[model samples]
Target: MKIFGLTGWSGSGKTTLAVKLLPALIGRGLRVSTIKHAHKGFDIDHPGKDSHNHRMAGATEVLVSSPKRWALMHELRDEPEPTLEELVRKLQPVDLLLIEGFKRDRHPKLEVWRPSVGKPLIAAEDPTVVAIASDGPVPDARVPVFHIDDAEAMAAFVVEFCGLRA
Candidate 1:
């Protein structure tokens, strides 16, 4: 699958942009999947859920399936966190994969920036950042800039950057 990324500091609206961009890409008849990197530990299954119980009962992997959907939860146990490439390989093929975070990985990315966040631009140090989406002008940006609210434009950029056809 063609891969692209959105990276930014905390509270810079990367998730918001990604959420908007999904439908824009889907509206163009493209199949898209997303992978988000969370800095803190997260859980999808709650304590009372059967899947959660199975996992807690020493199941290495627990897969829950229904008519509508299925999800596989794998326990890392002693295994280290998988790399981006390893995680990507586990996904079913799609026209595009939009990754959020993983800024250190060498993939084409758009930096979601907001001056109000009081953080410096990541594009300055990351060559893989091909563009910036910001609420205000990025005067010193070496790459192209887009308004943060322009999901259509950003989606189009992603399609073009990944060479994905509608």
Candidate 2:
């Protein structure tokens, strides 16, 4: 699958952009998947849910399924975090894979920037950054720059970057 990354400082709208981009890409008939990286402890299970009870009962992996959707939750018992490549291998095949983090990975990426954050732009330092989506105009850069509010345009850019026919 083609991999595209979204990276930015905290509260820089990466999640917001990702959420917007998915449906737009899907609207264009592309099968898209997402990989979100979280540094802190994260859980998909909910309290008082059967899946949560299963995990609490020492089940390492719990898969919950319904007619419409399914989820596989795995516990990394004393293991190191999996890399982006490994994580991608586990995902269902798609026309594109939109990664929400893993900025350090060697893949084509877009930087979601917000001037309010006052954080340095990663594109300024990372060559893998092919574009910037910001609420404000971005400084001159080698790659295309876009406005954060325009999801359709950003989705189009991502599709072109992946060499997909609209």
Best by lDDT: 1
Put down candidate 1 lDDT per residue, 1-166, tens digits, no spaces: 8999999999999999999999999999999999999988899999999999999999999999999999999999989999999999999999999999998999999999999999998999899999999999896999989999999998888888889898
- Compared with the true structure, all predictions reach lDDT values of 0.95, 0.90
Off by over 4 Å in 2: none
Candidate 2 lDDT (Cα, whole model)?
0.90
Task: For candidate 2, write residues 1-166 as lDDT tens digits.
Answer: 7999999998998898999999999999999889999979998789999999999999989999999999999999888999888999998899999999898999999999988999988999999999999888777667888888899998998898899865
Candidate 2 local Cα displacement, residue 96, angstroms: 0.7
- Cα TM-score of candidate 1: 0.98
Q: How close to the true structure is residue 86 of candidate 2, measured as C-alpha lDDT?
A: 91
lDDT at position 4, candidate 2: 94
In candidate 1, what residue range of length 10 has the lowest lDDT sum?
A: 154-163
Candidate 1: stretches off by over 4 Å: none
